[model samples]
Target: MEPVVLAAGTALVAAMASDAWEAARGALVDLWRKGKPEEAEAVGNELQRARTVALESRRTVDPDAEQALIGFWRMRLDHLLRERPDLARELRGVLEDDLVPTLGAGERDRATTLLGRAEAHDHARIYQAGRDQHIHGG
Candidate 1:
């Protein structure tokens, strides 16, 4: 998954739990409307339903449920981007201008961590940790 897409999807879900949700939702729907006109309304409705579910999970203190919602949106956005590569730039704009800024520091941190990854190639060892790590090897 593209890091920006992952970040944006997580941020969008987090934004659903924020006061700026309408704006974030609008931006998303607009993206769909522009890229996939036939699916705009359906996408808009899905966004609303997902937002409701996300909010409910947060209200009930269900972190896992909320994370699941994020994953759902991530897959949806990933598909959308794959189908309409042109929308990737617009998605990035929404993330930078709307979704991310609207989130709190903790939510922002969580969104950032959603894209975490570490890769190693041939003869290249990897020491990976979310926060801190030490590696000892030949």
Candidate 2:
């Protein structure tokens, strides 16, 4: 996934759990309105539904559900980016100036980490801070 698209998608999902969801959602809808006016209403409705799902997951402490929602939005944003390549910068701006700032400290930090890791290759081996060594032959 493109980094900006991943960041924007993650930020969008995180924003759904924030107090500023309405403002964030409005900006998202407006962006879509400018790029593809016909899909604006549908996007708005989907955002609302996503918000409901996000809130429910948060309330229930269902990380899996929230992650699923994130994946759903990631795919949606990926499609949108494919259709309107020029919107990448705009989406990044929304993440930096709007969505991220709206999150609480913990969520903001986590969202940042999520954004950073969004570009990670699935097949690549990852080694964390702790000292550990492994040899693998596949």
Candidate 3:
């Protein structure tokens, strides 16, 4: 379980570098450029907190650490979703189709269920378009 946790955390951190941090920085920069330095700083601080938590978490094997890591990822995802819903949808699909399938059985089931709930919540107010497509023609 420790190995599995390490592997998952590492993979997730790598993805975070490419997705979460990059997007957060871009948004922060945009905020800064638009005369919202406080907002930009707040976002940067949150991102730093997330990374600090992850780095410290990698040194231990506590079950509570897993939830902290998960919370970091969830917050990152939520930030991205709010800033760019279309990209968030694409990223969610990528996670569901690729990353989730590579996890252990229990983790995979949990991830799948979570993704379903996320999708439903994201589209809660919108009407469906068809059987295969989401309400937004997604």
Candidate 4:
């Protein structure tokens, strides 16, 4: 659930900076329409507002602002999923079928990809994970 919501939210924000924003917006609104027609209209409007801010963030090269927008949409998606757990598949559709392909090569990279770099010259250690990870040693 968390991964789907995270991917959808990331794709939502990424679409805002893409040339196919309108199409991506349509796909999102359509997804909402399936679960709740009334809320679909509101979602469309909200996407437009977010698009404005997202575009500004891109123009200024503000990663923080971009992350904020992603967080904003993630919350909304989380609530929707909580309300309708069955919508998970549809959410993935909106993410993979619509938003992802529209994104540029850089943005299309799966957000779950994690990279870590460590250099240990002596007796040293490093740890990294794409998600929940725990290390216990002495």
Candidate 5:
């Protein structure tokens, strides 16, 4: 391979790896907020390793597919990340402006259900965390 091509490939791989790490961290934080700290940490570690492998194979990996998968995970995180009312409102705005128009009746129903669950879980997790912190004085 040409040196210039190899350098570009390395740069692309680094970007991919960074994106993957961010996605994995978001996922782990989501899980931690949902009351599964151990599982979240495990998955986060695994994802970090996956990102390393993907970066090492950047020449062959499809960046588009990786992006699509990242989008999926990000959507999951957005739905579940309701700890901040401001963030939730912002996400809802995006959903209304972007996702709502694209969704049909069945899809809307599913989306609503999923959002409800995520919000409920987020609320509960926050409450528990606060309670724990109060009790522990930390």
Candidate 6:
């Protein structure tokens, strides 16, 4: 779950480097509004600020600054998820349909696809991840 949020956050910020980021921004703001209706305008304003920093960091060739922006967005998304878990699937939709598609050819390489499934029956428990995973007392 954390990994999925991280991937989506990273992809959304990466989309900021694209000229088509407005569409992505709109999609995200719409999602935020759907989940927390009162925060729609605020989220749009915040995303705009993030976009500004992302573009500036790119122009200065400052990867660290862009990384900081990704971290910030990731935290924000995490909170949003905590507040409204139902939006999780819609968040993924925005990532795939809006954010990733906004990336340019060069930036597209930074995007990753993750698939995870956990199944359990009776006394069993399952933990799944797209990459690394750990099991205790299995």
The per-residue C-alpha lDDT of model 6 at residue 91 equals 89
lDDT scores of the candidates, listed in order: 0.86, 0.83, 0.47, 0.85, 0.43, 0.83
* Pairs with backbone N, CA or C atoms under 3 Å apart (clashes), candidate 1: none
Candidate 2 lDDT tens digits, 30-101: 888978999999999999999999999989999999889888888988888889999888878888888889
TM-score of every model?
0.80, 0.79, 0.43, 0.79, 0.32, 0.79
Evaluate model 2: give its TM-score.
Answer: 0.79
Instruction: Please give the TM-score that candidate 6 achieves against the real structure.
Output: 0.79
- List, residue by residue over 3-104, the lDDT tens digit for candidate 6: 568877888889887888889999989998899989999999999999899989989999999889888988988989999999999988888788878877
Q: How accurate is candidate 1 locally (lDDT)?
A: 0.86
- CA deviation > 4 Å runs, candidate 3: 1-60, 117-138
Q: Which residue pairs show collisions in model 5?
A: none
* lDDT at 118, model 2: 30
Inter-residue clash pairs, candidate 2: none
How many times do residue backbones clash in model 5? 0
Q: Which one wins by lDDT: 4 or 5?
A: 4
Give the worst 10-residue stretch by lDDT in candidate 1: 110-119
Tens-place lDDT digits, model 5, residues 1-138: 222222222222233344334642453445445544546666565556656656655557676755544444454444445343344543444344434334455544534443332245543543433123454555
Candidate 4 structure quality by residue, lDDT tens digits, 1-138? 478888889888989988898999999999889888889999999999999999999899999999999999999999888988899889887887888888777777754242233587778766767679987776
Against the true structure, candidate 5 has what lDDT? 0.43
Worst 10 residues of 5 by lDDT: 1-10
RMSD of 2: 6.9
Q: Give residue 64's error in model 1 in angstroms.
A: 2.0
List of clashing residue pairs for candidate 3: none
What's the distance in Å from true for residue 47, model 1?
1.0
| TM-score, cand. 3 vs. native | 0.43
Model 3, span 1-138: residue lDDT tens: 122233333334433323344553344344333444456667566656655665566466454765666655555455544665555444544454445544556555555443333145653664443237634355
Candidate 1 lDDT over 79-137, as tens digits, reads 99999998888888888788888999998887777555568889986665776786667
Candidate number of the best lDDT: 1
Q: Estimate candidate 4's alpha-carbon lDDT, on a 0 to 1 scale.
A: 0.85
